[model samples]
Target: MKNAISIAMMALFSLCCAAQNISVQSINYPTRYLRHSDSKGYLGEMLSDLDRQDASFKLVNAGIPDCPNCIRFESVNYPGQYLRHSNYLIWLSALSSDLDYKDASFRLVQGLAGTDRVQRTTHADVFR
Candidate 1:
């Protein structure tokens, strides 16, 4: 009985951890979600809103030694590239060596609405 309880507890813990994956949703457009709508996953891809599945993303730790608050948005479907912003638009791109695209890094904070949360860009310091 004790062994069974331990196994059940461990399984519960793993499920709780996996449930923590975060997503970036539009505050202005509540029905729309941030995602890639382009055929080619290249730079300057169509960063638009969608009503369905591809919109969800995982908020990953940027892994920067100095920046603890910084985070990278990794797609639930495409794990390699991260959600990047350029020209006031958001798209996915791979983590390059120089890391010049730190604009992609954002801090999740209390949004305009009291209970809601927002992904504020670290570079421009604007809510998305």
Candidate 2:
């Protein structure tokens, strides 16, 4: 009975952890979600299973060791790849250098419009 209870608890914990996966949606276009295609990030409507998978991401700790408060968005389908911006455009890329880590890390703040929405703001200090 104790072993069964332990197993059930472990299963519940796994489900709770899996629930951390999130889909980033556009504020203006609620029907559209952030997705990567051809390594580029764009907003698209989730019409198929592939679309949904592309839209899904896991919020992980920042890849940079110095940025403890920052978070990085890791692609659900592409485990090692993370959401990053380069040349003022978002892309799904693998971390290779400090610049890549900095580009991927973002601080989550309350949206300017309201608290109901969350905004991912780049770490200005690192960028500048």
Candidate 3:
């Protein structure tokens, strides 16, 4: 039981590390405690974890946009499948690039106005 728990946690850490251009850091996005976010900066499966050990997290968005194909995710019992999808990771990388561009643009705008910019920082979605 102890080894299994350790392995599961390790898999979770790897998922966090899968973010593009990610820096080495303590991975702590436990699916059990994740709260939903749709702040444009948030990503990953709409649902966090379904296991009884933790609460299941769903997106916090009040309303769904008219997007045709909403992204969905199902947690896997296996570690390998939990973090190895090309298209999913590719989408995450694109989201990261988009966030970088958006942040820079906002900073430039604030700098010219001589105003202290409010930071809208977000993590690079680990799905990438």
Candidate 4:
């Protein structure tokens, strides 16, 4: 009887500990990790997994990027000497130019496929 009582108390202690989840986050930013694909061949292949059973379907939301801010690329007066293309990262802080194009293409092709996965957007829908 004592052994069974001890086991039950141990199980109860574990359950209480599990209930107290430790959240070690200071801040949360709205960010997404879209698959980046440079090849046209991969575009068609990305859609094959978006069946009805899959809950994590493709999605696209058009808004200002979280990084590289709202500054237009052409407007920036980039000094090509000390801050050469190699040293650009240290100068302007964060530059996500490659991610802007590469990830977008993957997300777009996902939209084009019109699966049970993608939330469809038409030209009309974009205007509103």
Best by lDDT: 2
Per-prediction TM-score to the true structure, in the order listed: 0.61, 0.79, 0.18, 0.15
- The residue ranges of model 3 lying beyond 4 angstroms of the native Cα positions read 20-34, 37-128
Query: C-alpha displacement of 97 in model 1, angstroms?
Result: 3.2
Which sections of candidate 4 miss by over 4 Å?
Answer: 1-56, 65-128
- Answer with 3 or 4, whichever has the higher lDDT: 3
Worst 10 residues of 4 by lDDT: 75-84
Local distance difference test, candidate 4: 0.23
For residues 2-82, what per-residue lDDT tens digits would candidate 3 score against the true structure? 444345334433443353211111124433222123211123333433322121211111111432112222122221111
Comparison by TM-score, 1 against 4, better one: 1
Q: Pick the candidate with the highest TM-score.
A: 2
In model 2, the runs with Cα more than 4 Å from the true position are 1-19, 63-68, 126-128
Q: Write candidate 2's Cα lDDT for 9-74 as tens digits.
A: 344334334647878889989999999999999999999999999998987766455555467888
Angstrom error at residue 47, model 2? 0.7
lDDT of 1 by residue, 30-53 (tens): 654555656222222224434233
Query: What lDDT would each prediction earn against the true structure?
Result: 0.54, 0.78, 0.24, 0.23
| Candidate 4 lDDT tens digits, 64-110 | 34421111111012211111022112111123564433223211112
Order the candidates by TM-score, highest first — what do you get? 2, 1, 3, 4
Rank the candidate models, highest lDDT first. 2, 1, 3, 4
Alpha-carbon shift of residue 25 in model 3 (angstroms): 24
